[model samples]
Target: MASDFDDPGYDYAVSVAGRAVRTMAEQRIPPMPTNFAIWFQYYAGSHNNLRNAIDLLIDHNRPFDVSTNQDLFETCIAPEVSAVVVETSERLQA
Candidate 1:
C-alpha cells in the first residue's frame, strides 16, 4: 500500500535541519530537543505564534535565555507533544 505521508525528501529535510541548527547557533539557544523543535517549526513556517514570538524577541534584542526558551516551548510545543503522547497511548491501549 502507498503511504499517505508527504515526504519532503532527503535534501529538503537536510536543508531544514541545517537552518534549524544555524538559527539555534545564532540565537545562542542550546541544541536541546525542545529548542531545536522551536527553530525547526519557525523555519518550516509551521507555527506562526512561535515564529512571531521569536521575531518579537529579535526585534527587541531580547536574549533567548533558559527561561525564555522554556516559556516558548511550553506555550507553543507542549500542547502538541501532549496530544501526540495521548494519541500514542490510546493506540497502544487499543
Candidate 2:
C-alpha cells in the first residue's frame, strides 16, 4: 500500500486535504476535513471509481463540503471546488 501523500495519481483535492490535515497535526491549525485521506486512498486504488463517486456527488446538487468538524458557517465553500480540478485531472489522465 502506498503512503497517502506519496501516491502520484492521488486526487488533487484529496492531496490538498492531506496537506491540510498534516498542517492541522503539525501546526495545530484546523484543516478542511471530510475523510480526505479516504478519498486519497480510494483514488490511488481506482481512479475511475473515484470519478464516478465525484460525478454522483455533483449530479445531486451538493456543495462538496469538506468540513467534518468545523463551524459550518465559517468554512469557505469555494475551496471545496478544488475537488473538481482534482477529479478532472485524473479523468484527463485516464
How many clashes in candidate 2? 0
Q: What is the C-alpha lDDT of each candidate?
A: 0.82, 0.45
Residue ranges of candidate 2 with Cα displaced over 4 Å: 1-34, 38-45, 65-94
Candidate 1 lDDT over 1-94, as tens digits, reads 1121136578977898899999889878899998987887777776788889999999999999999999999998888777777877988999
Error of 1 at 39 (Å): 0.6
Q: What's the true lDDT of residue 92 in model 2?
A: 92
Best by TM-score: 1
Q: Give the TM-score of candidate 2.
A: 0.27
Q: CA lDDT of 35 in candidate 2?
A: 42
What is the TM-score (0 to 1) of candidate 1? 0.83
Instruction: Report how far off residue 80 is in candidate 2 (Å).
Output: 23
Clashes of 1: 0
